[model samples]
Target: MTTVGNRSITLEDFYQILFKDNAIEISPAAQKRVSDCFAFLLDFAKEKLIYGINTGFGPMAQYRIDEHEQAQLQYNLIRSHCAGQGKPIDTVYVKALMVARLNTFLRGKSGVHPDVVALLTAFINRDIFPVIFEHGSVGASGDLVQLAHLALGLIGEGKMWHEGRQVPASEVLAAHNLTPLSVHLREGLALMNGTSVMTGIGVVNLIHSRNLLNWSLVSSSLLSEIVESYDDHYSAELNEAKHHPGQQQVAAQMRAILQDSDLVRKRHEHLYDKKVTADVLEDKVQEFYSIRCVPQILGPVYDTIASATTVVMHEINSVSDNPIIDKDKGSVYHGGNFHGDYVSLEMDKLKIAITKLSMLAERQLNFLLNNKLNNKLPPFVNLGRLGFNLGMQGAQFVATSTVAENQTFSFPMYVHSIPNNNDNQDIVSMGTNSAQITSKVIENTYQVLAVQLLTTIQAVDYLGFEDRLSSVSREVYQQLRALVPVFTEDGIMTEKILKIKEFIQAEHVQLPASVVGQPAAVAATELVAS
Candidate 1:
């Protein structure tokens, strides 16, 4: 069981809550803090006028709502803001959004009742996910529209995904022997006003992006071995001079992945050995940029993902709602923590990094297919009759097109905000859109990397070095080859490419222990085992 509000939550905790069905228990201290905060709000409500407690919302805030009708006002706010449109997001994301929102309330500043927090926890524990739409959030003033739909599910008014089916929340609650919640005071506003959607989606994207980075490292290492490239470029002396942590880390992992390889030649061995001629030695002296600059190109991507992880973890644990209740000071503070600019900008950077990674993979695929650049490999990587078989030629075209599409998706969504909310929100951060596009780019990159790995395995088989690959590279090649056979003659490759993509995204391919973080590596293994 996972305990909320006891300490800061990590990305692994969120993953457990979303995927592992880990039950959540709000810490007793957190319950007391929430109770104390709510009690203070009730006491202060008699003597003062508070925003969202007795006043209207947004542009209507100028109009004063009567104290008796405040409850009605809060209820109406949730129903009216359930104006989200487009397709429903995955249930895992909805559950993640709930977890993010609940963590904010756990800070004891949102002024929500302890029961509200408990109910949210129950939703997660029971796998009751709210049906949240993909659109309708400006990512400022919170993910108002989508979160409002979540708020409706909490009150048993909207649709929910339960037992693998979308059903009315009321029916699901009834079946589970649960009662719908009654909003009191500012509870509805507390629920709907936050950056939960953006943060939740960003967290999920960050997790997948980390996995993708690990796989890209594996793919790049495999490419190095397949091309029989020089390992001097990844020498420790060279990377240490660069003084980049990510660059140094990549160099170490690449060296480990390519350890004990018969194919990858040392500079001195190729230069001094009498068996090799000057022409062959010159060709082995330097590789193309794609193979030569693996660390230089992918190193910054590693650092960017690390930076994005920091920003996302902070956002998940932050109190992003308005009108924060301070029990100690006995006052309410209205601030703009709901703005998602931090997450939006970080996600934008992540997409660009992922796109660059995909471009590198596509270039490597091109190198492997072209006979001249491939170090005397057969044309089109075909092992059969030259003109009769096309091998992975069609698949290479698909990979190139996907990389181009990813480039287009790399355009920053943060720069294209439009004013909304009756012009009250003049500049908005399209954070949800940014996260969504980041996910799409990652999906496309997976296919690109899949094409690269598939082509590498085919090339390895054609070169008759399948049994002589580096230990780690052999494990990765065998794992992929078990799922997808080498293409001797090209037929319909769509299914084979997708199967490889599934293996990549599923993280079934084992990477060098040094490349993947300890926690993530364990998680991936556990996920595959389960």
Candidate 2:
């Protein structure tokens, strides 16, 4: 179980709530703080013209609202802003948005009534998710359109995802014996004025990116074994001399994965006096850059993922709304804390890193498929009659095409701002678009990595030395083989490829605890601080 708003929330905590069926509770202290803040706001708004309270919002802020219509003002804000137009976002992301927004309110700085927080908590705990759309946010002024849809759901005015189906919010709330939220004072503005959309998507993206990174390392190790590559490239002395912690960690992980493999050649075995076979003598002294530079290439990726995780985690735990009420000082400060620049920049960096990782995996897949580069493996790793089978020839093209798609999405969304909101939000973050692209990139990467895994297994089988595989590699190979059969006959492969992608995405395979540790968990902490 997890307690929302009582303390800082981590990515892991959010994942637990979403995937682990963990229940959530709002603490008494948080409720009291929220009540106190709302009381202060009510008293403060009676005399002074407060933004989103007695006064209008955005470009119309100069106009004052009649006191009798304050509640209607809040209601109109939610109704007018329900402008999202794309397909409904996945329920999990909407839930994440709710949790993130709830956390912000729990900070007791948004002047939201405690009932608002309670409704959000109930939504999460009951698995009732709002029907938020994908294309409504510019990531400035707090994802207003998308969040307005969320606010609409809270008021039993929009659609919701209930029991795996879309239903009217009024019907769902009625069935659950819950009452629609009554917006009071600044509650509507507080609900819509934040970065929950980007933060929620970023949290999910960060987790998927981490899983991809781990699987990339595993795939690299398996490729090295398949090619009978030399172990000198991952030597501890070489990585230690570079003094890069990420590089060293990659080297360590590679060493751990390739530890007991007989296929990886030791340096001493290449000595002139060893009396090796002629084929052994002809082996390249070094490998292609994709195989030789795993540490250097993927080291920065690891660090970037760690850094992005830190930024996203901090965003999840922060109070990112405007007009922060400092009850202690008895003052309200309106600022642009809702700007999603932090998450936008980090997501851009993460997408580029993931793209590079996919590029490397594609190259490795080529090395395993092409006869000229794959040593003794047959062309396309085909095992059928020489002229009859195409094998994985077409699959490699798909992997390359996916990699190209990833490159296209890798462009930074944060740098392309356009004016909206009557130019009040002249410079926007486009964080929701950035994070959505990052999510697609991650999906594409999973497919690319799936291709590599499938090719590696085929190559290993062609070599007929499965007995020599490292223990972990053999275990993973067996697990995959259980799902996908060897493609000796050359038929349609779309289903097979998708199954592997799903398997990876579902995290059915995991590295042993020894290969990943506390170092990986905290790698970005220091980087984030700097």
Cα displacement (Å) at residue 337, model 2:
0.4
**TM-scores of the models, in the order given:** 0.95, 0.95
Candidate 1 lDDT, 393-487, residue by residue in tens: 88888999999999999999999889988988889899988988898898898899888888888888987887778887888889899998776
Write down the lDDT that model 2 would get: 0.85
Q: Write the per-residue lDDT of candidate 2 for residues 1-530, one digit (tens) a residue.
A: 79767788887677677766799988889999899999988787678877888889998999999989999999999999998997888877888888899988888899998889888888889988888899988898989999999999899998988777888999999988889999777889999999999999888787777788888888899888888888989989889989777788789888988899988988786754487657645778788999999999998888888788878878878888888987878989888999999999999999999999999999999988889886689988888877799888889999999999999999999999999878899999999889989999998999999988988888878888689988878877888898897768978889889888888887334556556642222222233323
- The stretch of ten residues in a row with the least summed lDDT in candidate 2 is 518-527
Off by over 4 Å in 1: 272-282, 507-514, 517-530
- Model 2 earns a TM-score of 0.95
lDDT of 2 at 93: 81
Top lDDT: which candidate number?
2
User: Candidate 1: lDDT over CA atoms?
Assistant: 0.84
Instruction: Sum up the clashes in candidate 2.
Output: 1
